[model samples]
Target: MVRITDEQIEQWRRDGYVLIPNFLSKEETEAARNGVFEWFSPSWDDYVAAGRKIDKPGVLAFPWDNSGLNKAVLHDDLIDVAERILGTKDIHLRLVRLDEAHLGIKYAGNPSNNSLPDVFHQDWGNNTIGPHHPEDFCSPAFFYCLDDVKPGMAPVQMVKNGLEPNPKNAEKFICPGGSLCIYSTWTWHASSEFEAKEGHRPTMWLGFNRNDRMWEGGRFFTIKATGTRDGWLRAIGEATPRQRELLFLPAVDDEKWTDEMIDGMFKRYGKHGFDPEPYRQAKAKREAQTNGKH
Candidate 1:
């Protein structure tokens, strides 16, 4: 299991994203690599980029789903990391896409790659959910690199504190093999264009969104993508500190939060729109179910 420290947690709260190296072991990484191809596919490259589909999917794409791609969707390590980061019991696995562009495919976002619209926009446009855009309330995502990415051969460019403003100019994340990038919904990031400096770039994008209808993290896979890693990432979530307080999680109840509890926290800290009475009762019931209540 991976260990997290106060520094890492603080970094996430402050920076909107954290870099974790070797998130998966060589064995696990290999297992994921083999898992995708274990099924069926014609080429080492994705069926899409091989001129299979036009009007291509930019950086986001995938294959398989809850009803399709079998167990790779339940990768063990991915689940553990999600649990620590999301702090909720329910995690809805989103799309799994491997991005590795070749010379042939059609670019979709902005025809003129030089003036592409792939600038900066939070997945939740204006932080609202409706008919226009679907993805809402998606908290975090796991970007795993299956191979060694040497700069130009397709690296991910992320802003430093994107929840606010990214002073860094397209920071290229050069994480070696067996590492994963953990990013919250607030961070603004982009997948760099794939250029084979030495070896072919192979990366997997596994996203998890909250299971709320208001959140469309589970958006549909609708276009042609680049190379396919043929691997999978999994996710599991544990109740967060906020969730525990809202649900009165007995499992974590013993922790000293009394200081906040005495300060009119019921009105101050809970969801802004809900009533405190129902929340407390619901919290009590949920706490009784979880053990170690606060």
Candidate 2:
């Protein structure tokens, strides 16, 4: 059973993420690859037509497979860890996709690689839905590598302590397999265009939250999350009623807000001390501009 050490757990809370080594077994890693093949191989026939994402070479900028896919969430292998981090047994996944980052003489995609690679920016651009009130996060993202990674292959880089109590020290860390990376909806990150640097082709995922108090991510215990041979638990499972509300993470009404709204917010927050002043200021300014146009 893989119990998340207090150190790893606390690192995630304080640093916005953490790194754990030798997290998955070879057999388990192979399973994740099989899942991708089953879903993406030309044989699946109409999997995408049914509204399922089909795996393909360039679908992701990295190489990946999903043989070790967790049945609980149907796509997120680390949802149990996510649940533990959120401190909620009941959880809902924002979205899930199996991916692969292939290696070669050079990176995949256009070799011309003329333009810059993925831009270094936070999620959802400026339209982040929350971080201000009890509402949905604009766009938090997560990634799980399906293979053992080398920093030169498909490495994902993030700013250390990128988004918490005020992110500082923009240092970058390489997340390897048996490991997953999560980021706030508003963190700044990036990658190079076939630079031949030390990194791995990593599968990436974008996920939202199903908790009123939402944090990006944490670690998981594979053996304990499910019976070693128990196939019943998949990636992400169903959410409870309370979880459903948190999943909705409703957008606060900017136009309808008042000093009374602020009062209600403080009372509701009580001692939790979760503050969204930054998000609120941003949202209000956007709303004001929109109203002015009308």
Candidate 3:
């Protein structure tokens, strides 16, 4: 598993973002890129034919529909980094977006190749939720590059410190394929114009919030899935226990796990590894604490 260093954490706290190069290996990155292309090829057409707006070339709200993509989100390195940054093991997923920019695409709906404008802004602008504390960590946006994000490949531009738009101080996320860039939700950032001479840009995005803030509608992103609840459940059924935990599936007393859910867990993780005893013990301990039992 990849580990986050103290220096990296300090940088994240200071700059509101941190870029980790080569987070995924070459083989893993290629697999993700291929998987994304295959998944989006058919889904994009289906989504548009179903009367949905084709604002982007290949944008999937919940690309977890692909099993490989689902596993990528629960990557041990990513989970470890998220836990270190959030200072908790109980992290909740807020959203998962797959963006694919095909070659010869232009800004907006126009056919011209003028590239998109740069508009740095925070993501929490419209979210009126709790834990509005500016200093407190609300969410971390993770971006995984499936292609080389060079100078003109619509790389993300971020201000050095905060929202002040200082072009001289801005940093472009120019990294090779498989790199991961993690930024705070409050950070002021924008994507640069896609000036790449050739090839397409594909990226995997994952948003996460600390679990303690779940009371303010903890599972907000769950509703953002593109398909029905049953479809989402079916997709996640292929995930392992650790992956399901990242998806915030009920493991303890929050809700009774259906027989299918249990069977799926066993099928994916096996009986020896798919143990629910820890959750049961934790629930009992919580009850004991409430009853003043040491």
Candidate 4:
């Protein structure tokens, strides 16, 4: 059901990126859109008074409090696509960011209405400290448009097989809300200019790579953030065990899941109704298998 076709996989191989139009249904798209606005615009009156300017675009790295975004971040389809391309089920989360681009603002230095953070560049150039070949399985990234992205609304600009920024070869990604753009960190891309007179562009970027190469990618938030940010704790409590594994938590049957460790997990996350039964069951199953072998 929620699987990508072989054609899509080939596209990624040939072009280093693929755009899945309407990856999310209207309801799901609206939910994510609502979350963006609710989190960004708490007070509409003041937001409107400020000329709909949100001061600056807001970014929530690994945000767990927003139910809509959390669902999309851990959506089954997202993982399905990642696993298919990475050729491994052992992938982990690299970046879970909710990014916003407000309109009607002038860029500081570049006077060119370009709303993106920087000029065209390969993500791997900054994502890694060393070199990487295009053939290597680098971090795969996603840009989920939370709202309709029309031309001149700062849609994503990418160059096919481009090693550097070449405006002549660059192509603009103009798609409706709920659309998803999947590309590798090795792909060359940048943000287009935001020239819309009235409107905003809200998008989310999710990135992941192989579990063994944890040092290769970056994320804004870390596990320790849970202590200070309630959203992190909430995410821990609410996430499914499979989803937790993506966060690099131990598997249900991991050797680390001793009674003490399980108890610690409960102590840390029981407040948000975290279920420990699965861990307990895994332990019992392992014990049963051991006794049977003996």
Best by lDDT: 4
Error of 2 at 76 (Å): 9.5
Per-structure clash totals for the candidates:
14, 38, 0, 0
Better of 1 and 4 by TM-score: 4
Candidate number that wins on lDDT, 3 or 4: 4
**Deviation in Å, model 4, residue 264 alpha carbon:** 2.5
Question: TM-score, each model?
Answer: 0.52, 0.48, 0.71, 0.84
lDDT of 3 by residue, 200-230 (tens): 5566767666777664222354535353343
The runs of at least 3 residues in candidate 2 whose Cα sits more than 4 Å from the true structure, single-residue gaps closed, are 37-67, 70-77, 96-118, 124-128, 131-141, 162-176, 197-202, 206-208, 211-294
| Candidate number achieving the greatest TM-score relative to the actual structure | 4
Q: Against the correct fold, how does model 2 do in TM-score?
A: 0.48
Give per-residue CA lDDT, model 2, range 44-157, as digits (tens): 233334343334432221212222443212333355555655666445455322211211212333222222444455544332333443123323356556555554443455
Off by over 4 Å in 1: 35-73, 96-121, 125-138, 162-168, 193-196, 212-214, 220-294
Angstrom error of the Cα, residue 227, model 3: value is 5.2
TM-score of model number 3: 0.71
Better of 1 and 2 by lDDT: 1
* lDDT of all predictions: 0.45, 0.41, 0.60, 0.69
In candidate 4, which residue pairs clash? Answer: none
Q: What is the lDDT of residue 263 in candidate 1?
A: 33
The candidate, 2 or 4, that scores higher on TM-score is 4
